[model samples]
Target: MRNLLPFRSAPAPTSKVAALAAVTAVVAVAAGIASAPVAAEHTDAHAVVRDGQNIRYAGLTVRIPAAGEGVQAAAQSTSGDISLTVTRSAEGKLVVKTDDHEHGDEDHGDEAHADEQAEAQAVTADSARPAAAKTCTDRAYALAGWKLPSFAWYYNPAGAPAAIAGTAASAISAGTNALSTACGQKRLGLVPSYAGQTSAAVQVGAAGNCIGNDGRNVIGWRAGSGRWLGMTCTYFKTINGKKTVTGTDTALNTQYKFFTTTANCNNAYDLQSVVLHERGHSLGLNHVSQSANASAVMTPALSTCSAGKRSLGLGDYQGLAALYGTR
Candidate 1:
């Protein structure tokens, strides 16, 4: 059940270990399918061709204008309340403009989702920063906990094409498997559910800026801004003085290439790395004490084409231990 699927940062409320149920506001704060021929090798819109192209960054849709021209391209948000425009103001600058009357609030975020996934691909080089790469040692986060003895997740494969939906299903399953291994005999575990596709219009939900609560922990995608790579908006309640995650909506950017194999690394993002970190959030873990362990998957900053994150570091496991209390 292991897939080499492709694909963190810190923010406020990241270090409050006692605040075990800190909402994962965003990935900057901080899936599924289609079977329609994979979109012709992911059109490279870096230079802006005669045709338009796209990629997903945090589920926002950003359409890149073709022919490398200075055209004001208007793209819509997955939430539909926002309209983001991508314009190249400088010779090599990505100027993003948002017409979203309703702005998302501030929250934890990570490596932003892609600007374009299909025909367009525009990432800000400035956005790329030095990330921590550990020597494969143990890491820990601020807090952790899971409500159910074990966790179950369902995916929505309705709108996307067949290939897309199927891959998401398998990749997410693989991601869950990895967590089960990392948790190491803990009562908390991620179990996949074939409950069915999401009844909600969007696979992922968010409040102003917070990952919204709908009890739909989904793995799906859409077109949007390159703000958050993945996010798990959760609902928690203090049960007997302990933070317990009642529900969550685990979501990823469907617009980016969720690499399932090493061969396709050059284009699509790393699906496993991104999804795994989001799962940590769902488990009541906050960012690894902001500005501390970038080497951990829960670290706030992420880089482009960095597949090293797909694997969990030792410190990551330590955090799990803290959250769930030894195997």
Candidate 2:
């Protein structure tokens, strides 16, 4: 069968108009010299991150993903970006690929837009057919190559609420285990081993925004606001001319409440389900449309107290198989 997932597109070329505007602004600054006050805008979880910024860690730069680049899977509820990966490029920049879901003022018109985008890019039939014959169910998954057979990650539950802190480790591990075993009996060789607790801080900015990759595989909770529920930043580096996975850090937004048990759910998000989805991104899988494949763990959005994502769906499995061959 043909692969039916969207591949990461190349970095967007700098637009001429924007470039010219930037040049004009720079000249104005040069003319003013010391006369004007200079204040650079800081990028945080709450700020809109520009595509190419000099946020550095360990000598590597950052490459933020363009908005609506893949699948057009906007948020079904609550505006937020989901399933983002940060990896090193050939030039040693951390290429960030994200599966984002937005709501509120940045609305995506309607679901029809998402359906239209998905249908336009997807391969529906085995042979060429008229555009009118294509269906929205013909969807695509996104993949990033992983060179390592296994990755070890450490967790820090320092800021997690007491309500579920005790069970956070096991609950989060279930999410990792779900992805490791997503390929079923054919078992893909990819493994996510828990390396116990660590004093290492998760590399998230004060407002819960993802910071530069710090070359440490750590997971923890941080206080944050805005629509984001969680974020995973995967670090990569060039080794022998190949951009390979180096490390990853994940942070859950303590600003939003989470529940581990059914009774205490209280309309909060499921801890395991959210982690499973984030782990999917860490495993090199991108978003599938929530409308098209709502059951898939890789879908861009989730609802409150929903625990169904703790298991992988068919498309989820197919995505894993595509990247790492089934055993």
Clashes of 1: 66
Q: Candidate 2: where is the Cα deviation over 4 Å?
A: 1-77, 80-140, 145-149, 240-242
Q: State each candidate's clash count.
A: 66, 5
Q: Please, what are the lDDT tens digits per residue for candidate 1 over residues 1-327?
A: 101111101111111122212232111100111111111111122221111243222333333322222111122222111222233322333323232111123112232111122211121221222244342443444342334334666676554434445576676666655665442334333343546666564334332123244555565654433445564545454455554555566556555455655565655555676677677666644444223444566554454555656655555555555455553
lDDT winner: 2
Residue 321, model 2, lDDT:
63
Which runs of model 1 end up more than 4 angstroms from their true locations? 1-136, 144-149, 159-165, 182-212, 289-292
For residues 265-288, write the lDDT of model 2, one tens digit per residue. 876888897887777766666555
lDDT of each model, Cα atoms only? Answer: 0.41, 0.50
